[model samples]
Target: MHTVDHLETLCARAWPALAEVPLGNWWMRAAEGFTGRANSTLTCGDPGMPIPDALKLVQRFARDHGIKPTAHVVNGSPAESGVEAAGWRVDLDHPGGAESLVMTGPLEKFADGVVESRDLPGWWELTAGSEITTAQRHVLGSGPNVCFASIVVDGVVVAAVRGAVVEDVLHVARLAVRPSHRRQGLARRLMGELAGWGLTQGATTCVLQVAEHNEAAIRLYEELGCTEHHRYRYWIPAVS
Candidate 1:
């Protein structure tokens, strides 16, 4: 199997969607339109049936959920061409609508401080602040093995990141820094804490997804010794 396929498979398991249904070998995910990752079909391996059948299943699932059907296709995968042939165009309105790079690196690179685990309330307050919606809470708390890592300045949480370990790979997400706390290496510090925690759970590598157009984040990941492992884009049904 390709490295991207492996990484993507691990990612799907690590960051599970709110609801999932099997369409042959594909996974149809829905999360009340929270984000593309949760709302789109995950075309990881062979869809197990004809392209038309798969598309129809996607449509039915979306209709049942009252969401516009979308497919998450890996770049250069056979499913990508199949979906495009079925009149599924890229979802331009979605964040990172074009393509997103999957980055990976050794967990040791960021394995530094001791990572502290927090309950939902503490994690939400530190990372998302107040006024978070129900969907966001569901997504953030979906993972079975998720940990929220933070770096405290004085006594306040200034930098935070989320990590989930699946199949021995650490899937990092939601790395954030307070506006007044940027450019002080807090992001890196958060990564170190999370990675260190992951290592204790038998994780050897780390992976994360970032939009291709996010140069700043891309640069930061690269600086942390992360490299592109794969790319993927979302496909929405073309309107007649």
Candidate 2:
């Protein structure tokens, strides 16, 4: 088992941002306008300056990249108070939800179906649901030693997932199933396929992030024997 900081570090590597800079120990990341995790400052460690000054740098980095300033902080981190005192508020309107839970367990426990190769016809459409952007392609398709998993039916991809093994941890994301195939366990199977592949790649631990409000996903992860390791939230400047 790894510390919260280590786990967070692994996740950052798994879902890398196109641009990243280190401030003290904090990571300022950006990927055009991909996702919050890709475009937020990971407030994991001390920034080696006053929190408010560090936050100013965070804002500058985000604005420079043409993204709204945001910070990702683990719950209970000492940095939280300083951020709030600086007038940053929790981004309750965040598309992914205000906060997310990091869940983890052994990949072998969830191993099931055979993993498939990358870019199976409808996989991108299913995952993105609309036009895919350069940032999405760069961040999702090109991660550290990444592999994609999919389930096909009648020559069409009905389910898909993205998996990457970073230092023995399998980071799973973007699991999507065709609407017509919902509740048929396709999501679980696709995850299994990814797990099988990750294990082969020397991954023993499986980690994924789910929105705190996503009860259904939480139930699914719990059923897979995944335990909540920690929760994180995004913060943005409070509106005046």
Candidate 3:
């Protein structure tokens, strides 16, 4: 397939899975939401077009759906070009850093362990320190396509991850382990479990979006045999 075609195909397969939420903006929108809705590039054509045109199209689509446009571009390496041409500020984010060598597999073995359901109120109560608002959690969990899990130890929830299945791909979203449980390989185990669930539900492969600066996540994903697929540009036009 052509470049844009390939990107759209991937987006169509991954976006809904990434967010696993509806597009209604009863709550405010974040830049991350736009990427999750991206799948139109296939229809738009590749090299795509001028940056402004691409931005306009995406922005229009987002707006129509009550979503605010917060554009982002993701490329594999610093050497890659055309990212800027897509109207996004370029930045390199490494998701997984040096925390490699962790083992990954299904969550079945740990299923009997203290895995708990983390709904909006519960998750918000735990992560109120960060920017996670109640609406964000609701949008994430309200959908049938999405589910969130937290591993509890000693009656305290320590590690967590969210999974969304869209099309035939399962996208892993917002995975984190509490500071106390960082080095115990819980994240990997959780990922393995999430991947297993996705596979069982007809997901052919799993994908996720991580920032370039997050070395820890990048390292962990690399260790999991995840490869760089496509780069996306996130554009938030400066308001005139």
Candidate 4:
């Protein structure tokens, strides 16, 4: 029963990656590096560019930046326009299913092994360090006004999940597990911990946004009983 207004606030607070994930700015933080915000439209992987240009832009962006760039096309734009106009084959827009639905619960009910504050910062650091794109890094690392949790194994930090309570809804931000520690159910454990925190923060429910193409992630969410809700159309103007 998460409302659109609530989700938007959650995205703004918890998942700054949606639109605020910093880009081209972090490189400035790095000595001798150049930074630029990810083009939201008309730059590359945008639906308004020519097909060949779109592909090339995508390839170049990924190659140079080490991250996949997505095109947010304006809905209702005729297939003959926008990305379609750009000469790219249209795959029926969202050939994928739908955005995942949100679920709410008491934090106490979800708490298991207990989430500790000592390990939270390190978990954030590791997760942020692993991001390939500046936007991803910003959300996971420097995004403003957020809360988080981390899981430790044998006294060693292994997994982490962060949530931001924005507009009374909890948006799960960065969730990460060490590559060497996969398949141990740590992520689920961390997610449970995050849910607990969300409830305490007055969040009515929790929401997460993931790429439609990420099958593995979608399956994991489904297994966790997360439902599919509405899909959001991501559109970047050819110039904006």
Candidate 5:
């Protein structure tokens, strides 16, 4: 079993940010406000200083990048306590959720399909609302060993997912199925395709992050034998 910290480190590489700065053992990441995971300080390990002092640096980094002063902390961890004691509060307004869980399981190989080095227009059409932002492209395209998998039907993409292999882990994200294509197991197919692709790359396990409130997605992952590895929440300076 991989420790929480080890798993987090792998995921960090799987979905890289445009900028990653180390604050002692902590990681401060920024990607032009694209996603919280990429745009917040990750309070994982010791920072070689008091928590309050570390938080000051975190806020300063946020201000320098024009993003929220946020920290991604594992729930119930010492870092979480320190951040809270320093007047940081859980971010209930985060678009993803107040809390998120990491799920992992052994990779199950399925069938092979076309994989892309760069996201296609259909992927952007399915995942984003408007023109793809540079920050989004940076984060998505920045993964060290990443692949874009999708299922095309009638010359249109109805489902898509991203997979990145970091060490022996396959980190999956950007799962989406067109509303009209739901209930047809396209999501599973895409996952299986990614699994096949990952296995070829020597990945033995799969990991993904999901919001705690997303029961449906959790159920799908559970069916694929994934279990909760850890839960984390985004924190920000208290609204005082």
Candidate 6:
């Protein structure tokens, strides 16, 4: 469990938010309205200060950054109960915001070459949906350790994924497959390539975040030998 916590911390660093303010052992992150993981306060371990004081600081940090005061609490952690007791409500209304699982596995099982690294522009063209927002661009291209993986077929990119390696763990995100290319084992192949890339970069493990409601994706990852490491949910102050 402790090692899982440390791996998660490294994963957070890999896909960094736009702004991160340290509050004891917690990280108050802000990146507009991009994603909960990027905007919420990540309470990994003890804050080293009073919980109330830390909450106040988190509130102030969110307000200063013009984002809603939100906290990402590990499901079974002390912080979850504390924040809920303090009037913070789990953000169930947000799209797929209720519960997310952090899945982990070794990088040696999947076969390589199904995916290849590409530049930001090429990666975005293949992965981004019909429209791209400023916040999306920043979140996808923010970190230096990121690798943009894509699958090109018949001279056109169809499947893509992103991997960021930090502290021997590869954090995978932004996986997409074109509608015409779905159900062809593209996602699995892409993950295999990502695992291969991670191994070459000295990464021993791979992790990816998926909403609990995403049954298909969850099944796919499970079939690939990834198991849930932990769960987390976003908690926001109840509206007065």
Per-model CA lDDT versus the true structure? 0.82, 0.89, 0.49, 0.49, 0.87, 0.82
Report the number of the highest-lDDT candidate.
2
lDDT by residue for model 6 (71-176), tens: 8888888788888888888888867558899998887866475345686455687666657777677777767577889888887778889898887888898888
Q: Lowest summed lDDT over 10 consecutive residues: which window, candidate 5?
A: 109-118
Q: What would the TM-scores of all predictions be?
A: 0.93, 0.97, 0.60, 0.57, 0.95, 0.92
Quickly count the clashes in candidate 2. Answer: 0
TM-score of 1: 0.93
Model 2 / residue 17 / CA error / Å: 1.3
Candidate 4, residues 4-57, lDDT tens digits: the string is 434433454454333322222110012011121222222212234445455455
Candidate 3: where is the Cα deviation over 4 Å? Answer: 1-69, 73-134
Ranking of all predicted structures according to TM-score, beginning with the best and ending with the worst: 2, 5, 1, 6, 3, 4
lDDT of candidate 3 over 1-240, digit per residue (tens): 124334334434433322322222111123333233332222223323554665565566557555555433333322123434544442222122211121222333332233334564444444433576444545455444665666677777677777766666566666878887799998987777777666666655566666545678878877777766554543344441
Residue-level lDDT for 67 in candidate 6: 90
What are the per-residue Cα lDDT tens digits for candidate 5 across 1-240? 888888888999887888899999899999998889999888888999999999999999988888888999998888988999999999999999989999998876343463554467988778664588888887887677888788889988889888899999999998999999999999987887788888889989999999999999999998888899999999999963
Give the top-scoring candidate (TM-score).
2
Kindly list the per-residue Cα lDDT of model 1 for residues 176-199, writing each as its tens digit. Answer: 888898998888777888888999
Worst 10 residues of 2 by lDDT: 113-122
Worst 10 residues of 6 by lDDT: 113-122
lDDT at residue 40 of model 5 (Cα atoms): 89
* Candidate with better lDDT, 3 vs 5: 5
C-alpha RMSD (angstroms) for model 3 = 7.5
